[model samples]
Target: MTEIVGRLAPSPTGALHVGHARSFLLAWWHARSRGGRVVLRIEDLDRERVKPGATDLVLRDLEWLGLDWDGPMLRQSEDEEPLRAAVAELLERGSVYPCFCTRREIALSAPHVTDGEVRYPGTCRGRFASAADGERELGRAPGLRLAVEPGELALEDGFVGPFTSDVEREVGDFQVQRRDGALAYQLAVVVHDARQGVTEVLRGRDLLSSSARQWLLQEHLGLPHPTWYHVPVVVDEGGARLAKRRGDATLVELRERRVDPRALVAWVARSSGVNAPDRIGARDALEGFRLDAVPKEDVVFGARERAALG
Candidate 1:
């Protein structure tokens, strides 16, 4: 049997919050408990949102929680060769086409879905013969979008169980590369997962929709799919998901208040349906870790939870 490989990928767009803590701790527990190797990857490719010194804070918080990973940490921006190669391969295989539609144009063409995604209507599909043709005709650079086929793609998530999605109907042809020459998240994540030999993926359920599109890319690129686990996400009292931009119960705030990291770990463990002491190390909570025991509903993070952490 192949050794299980997992990843702790965090975007340095903002400070780590309690919501992030829960997800990271669960991910750490899930991998470490099974004696698996966990690779750390900094997803800072979104230069527009990447915060200065945010990466250091993320590292600091992870260390504070005693979430250790194997091997050297990777930055998505550190290497562009693999990303470029993946895009090139897709282009060569005719799996993708140039998209010249701007954001505003796409938005005006359709209403935003519940997940805040606008199901792309294949606006630029076959609109141009090539990237050069798109630029020549539109007088601007063109992004690359996968020519998604219309059909349902099913998957069995390690945690969420059976799931299905039709990328074409849900999101249509999605972009692999942006017009600004940046590799989109879907493409970047697939390339990184393949290159790092990640055998399992455990993250927030909010990204569950992405698995279908990623599966398509994997098949197109001949890359293997990893075991998927889309666990529940932490939301505020109002049921709104926490965002780094909102400064919602940040770990930094807790640290400044002298809140014990172990306390936070205990809270996370309990929230995930595990019984833990008032203060417990992340590793200590892994003794009888079971994925099935984790709650399927979104975990609430509000005043009561914060008070408990202190």
Candidate 2:
């Protein structure tokens, strides 16, 4: 049997909130329940948005929750060479090309996707020999975009059942590298997950659309595709997704009030539609971990619960 490997990829760009806790806790439960190893990965590639010394705080939060992960923690920024190498390979595979369109220029023609990000329409896709060549033509560095194949890319999500998205129509050639020379999230995740041997990707359902994008990347690179479990996300009373910057839903705030870690764990379990005792540790929650126990729709956090996470 193939070994199962999971990851807790926390980007230290914002505060770690309850929404993050629920996702991380479930990821831990799913991996450990099957004697699998959970790899701790710090995704701090977006240096401009990354907070100073936020990784330590994230580590403390996870440790307080009593989740044990195997091996040393991996930082995405430290693996830039591998990421760049993947980009180079994609360029050579004829799957990706240089894009010289600026954000404003792309916005004029690109369609707004569900994620609120604009998808490129192949304006500069075949015009440049390379990104540097695009700079010579446009007088500016160019972003790199992948040439997605036509047809509906469908996959069975562990929690959401079968999900499909038209690669050509819905998601046009997406960006792999930005004009700022920074790697795009889609490409970074695909390369990292493949290189790290991530056999199972357990995260929020909001990223469901990204699955097709990443799936295509794996297919192009001849890499192994992992099983996906896009669990329901946590939202506020206003029905908006939770954010750490909001402060109230943050673990740091709850910890300040002396909230018990196990109690928080129990709350997360209940919130996810899983039945558990009042006080349960990370290990205890894994006693009967099943993806089906998690809700398919986003869980709303009312005013009262949001006030204290109790």
Q: What is the TM-score of each candidate against the true structure?
A: 0.97, 0.94
What is the alpha-carbon lDDT of model 2 when measured against the actual structure? 0.83
Candidate 1: residue pairs that collide: none
Each prediction's Cα RMSD?
Answer: 1.2, 1.8
lDDT of each: 0.89, 0.83
Off by over 4 Å in 1: 112-114
Q: Across residues 1-310, which tens digit of lDDT does each residue of candidate 1 receive?
A: 8989999999999999987888888888888888889999999999999999999999999999889999999899996799999999998999999888888898999785637898888888877667787788779988889999898987899998898898888888999998888889999999998888899999999899999999999999999999999999999999999998899999899999999999988888887878888998888999957778998899888999888776
Please give, for residues 114-220, the per-residue lDDT of candidate 2 as tens digits.
56867667787668666677677679877778897779876887767898888777768888888889998887887888777789999988888888988988898
Best by TM-score: 1
What shift in Å separates residue 71 of candidate 2 from its native position after superposition? 0.9
Determine which window of 10 residues in candidate 2 has minimal summed lDDT: 301-310
lDDT of 2 at 100: 79
